[model samples]
Target: MNKAKKMLFSYSFLAPSIILTAVLGLYPIAWAMRYMFYDYKGYGQEKFIGFDNFRQIAEDGLFWDSVKTTFIYAGGKVLVSLPLALLLAVVLNRGLRGRNVLRAIYFMPTIISSAVMAVVFFTIFNSYNGILNQFLMKYHLISKSIDWLGPDHALFTVIIVAVWGAVGNYMLLFLAGLQNIPDDIYESASLDGAGKVQQFWYITIPMLGPVLQIIIMLAIINALKGYESIMVMTGGGPVGKTEVMYLYVYKLFFPTAADAGGAVQQIGYGSAVGFVTALIVGAVTMVYFFFSRRMSRTF
Candidate 1:
């Protein structure tokens, strides 16, 4: 076939996906950009107010609070989950019976529906008569049942659940990176009288540079986008304590029926928040990669 025909044939296969993306992904974003300059519900007449939505978001303390909450949630998840995942991966990489079965068991949570898991945890973490509290009381750990979803502890609870669901996937990534390392490298290091800990620090980590960078980037982005479980579990809370960025956007755009009368339904403002969040996430990803590259170079 001619070069032009070959190109046409190749692009034909991609046409459906490109069209779907434009319609589903790019179009919504473009529409949101347009909407941010207007005041309107998702449907009906939109009156363009020109940067008013942006100004409103900047002035909204609640929005800023949500931003802080988002950072805290994401940071907590990454810090706690990634290290635990790496540890699990390292342990599983050793020669052990039923290691494959154990790996599957660890990864099972990652495949489960986030909403379902959140609901299950909701029952488990309930203030009165929950299994956790029951067990603790039985063991004489406390005099009273603690409210796990209360204002003081809701964010912490969310972080624990997020980490539990996240560790498995990242652990699998670390395992993949670990498996790719040739056995001969570890043998050579062992011959040099290097211990397992020394091999991991000086050899495994340095060698897993590229994979580690990708895993970190993915974890950060995923953590930043936390929404489903928090929604199902806390609904942004006992006084907005667990209201991360995505949940805040959801509340703005789609208030509950009971709140509908009081809620303004600020779709434009929500769009602005979404757009700004996208920018923030993008910036964070870039910064992470830049520092990651520097660290890789140093190593």
Candidate 2:
């Protein structure tokens, strides 16, 4: 083929992906952007009410409550899972038997469907007649069955489930970063009588700094954006206790029979909420980047 023809052929290979992205991803975002300022229900005229939707959002106590719950859930998941994942990666990076098998076992959850995972956890954590309650009763661990999915504990329970699903993915990331570090650095440190903990703190951590930052950023984003499992498990909960930002946005767009004695959708308001939620996630990412820069300079 001639050079121009060859170039055209190469571009043709990317045509489908470009078209699909424009249709599915780009189009929806553009639509939402246009709708955020309007006051259109699903089956009405496209009324452009300007910043009224944003104003409504500011006054929406439930939306702000959802934001608070989101931060709590995201904070709990990242704080608990990242350290656990790092510890697991460090141990498994050693010359342990069946480490590969163990890695696969840990990563299995990442591949599971969020809906299926939530269902399984729901069975285990049901307020009454759950497997966990049964086992606890059998072991006499508590005088009464614990309500894992109750309003009081729903947020905490969702955090635990989120951590469980996320740890494996972060562990693999940590493992990859750990593997990239040269063994010679550790060997030289060992020769100088640096113990394993000292080598880890001084050498491994420093070497893995760039990868660690990326992993942390991903974790924060994932924690903030994730709501599928929570949606399925509690549908934003017994009383919005487990409702996060994304889940709240979902409910606003697709309010179900469970909401407020049969709810209706709010497409315009939901679009506004979605846009604000994206901004919140973006703001968080910027803050992390800011701190990471300072941290890199400090070390």
Candidate 3:
């Protein structure tokens, strides 16, 4: 076979995946971009309105609220989960008995579906007759059952659930990174009178920089893109207190009406919200990358 025919055969093999990606991924992105320039409803007619949708989005208070909520949710999840994961990884790396079993137990949550987890948490966080409240009451932690899904407590509940769902994955990441560090380094540090803290600070942390960077990046992206859990747990409800950007976008597209009660038929505005969200996520990711790179250099 000649070079051209070989190339053709290679291209033929690649065609299906390329075509599928274009159809599923690229097509919607392009369609969303196109719709962003228009006053397109969920269906029927679409009228081009230039930057009107963008302007409205800019002026929308709800959009800004969602943005704030998204940042808070993302920041809280990352801050809480990463350190906890690292700590757990370090503990597990100490070669304790049943460490593998404990790691599996921790990681099991990550493999479970987010929706399923949401349902489980939903039951756990039930304001009345909930296990958490019952435990609190039994232990004298609280005199009465607290409303976990109330307006004030809703976001906090979601954050706790988010952390629980996320920690296992990052723990596994850190565990793998921990294993990759040379045992000789730790032994040398120990010989030099370096304590556990010193060994971790001077050796382990430095070696884990690359893995830490990747984990942090993924955590930030996951936090920013969070939707399913919030949707299933709170439905972005209790007066939109837990309404992150994704759920806000979902609601914009499928607003509850007087008759339908919970209907979202505004695809264009949702697309516009999605576009804005993409921009925010991209900017945040860039900032994270910049800081991570700088930190890596420092180490």
Candidate 4:
């Protein structure tokens, strides 16, 4: 085909996807950026207020509080989930009977809707009538029922739930990475009188570095973007003790009477928060890539 005709054919093939992405994705991003410079209520009046919204976000105590909460939530999810997922992946990577069934069982949580999982966990973590407390009481582990969703335990509960929901996906990723490792490498390590631990440390882990890098990137991204499960489970409740950045931003756009005196229906402020979050995540990803490159050169 002629150059122009070939170019036109390529563009035709891509047009549908490009159009859909522009409409569904890029349009909202543009809208958010525009709204970020204005005092936009859900309807009616919108005043173009430049950097005032961003300035307010900078000065807002609740915004800072949400930032702290976001870090805690993200950190907790990564710290707890990644190790467990790696361990599970290693265990399943062994040529064990029923490994496929076990893998499916673990991954079931990932396939289920977050809202449904939240509801299931809500019942499990219920204060008095829940199965967890009941089992504890039955075993005489505690004389009284523990409130899993109380102010003191709410954040921990959320973290535990998040980890449980996330581990399966990471496990599958790790398993795929593990499978790609050449058996000859491990066999050579064994010939060198290396134990299982030494083989893992010297051969498996080094071989899996690329996969680990990808896993870390994914974990950080998901941790930062964590919202739906928290929204469904706690609703950033128990006096905002469990409030993370995404939830905080969500409340900004869809304000409740309890959020910021119900006077802060600022779409601009929310968009600014979104922008900041995107930047933070991008920076983190870039750092990961930088480190990965260095590690690749060194190892």
Give the winner by lDDT: 2
Q: Candidate 4 residues 8-125, lDDT tens each?
A: 9999999999999999999999999988888887677888989988788778887778778888989999999999999999999999999999999999999999999999999999
Which residue window of length 10 is worst by lDDT in model 4? 258-267
Q: lDDT scores for all predictions? A: 0.91, 0.93, 0.89, 0.88
Which one wins by lDDT: 3 or 4? 3
Query: RMSD of candidate 4 to the true fold?
Result: 1.5
Clashing pairs in 3: 254-263, 254-264, 255-264
Look at candidate 2 and tell me the lDDT of residue 228: 100
Stretches of model 2 off by over 4 angstroms after superposition: 1-7
Q: What TM-score fits each model? A: 0.96, 0.96, 0.96, 0.96
Instruction: Give the higher-lDDT candidate: 1 or 4.
Output: 1
In candidate 2, how many Å is residue 166 off?
0.5
Q: Ten-residue segment with the worst summed lDDT in candidate 1?
A: 257-266
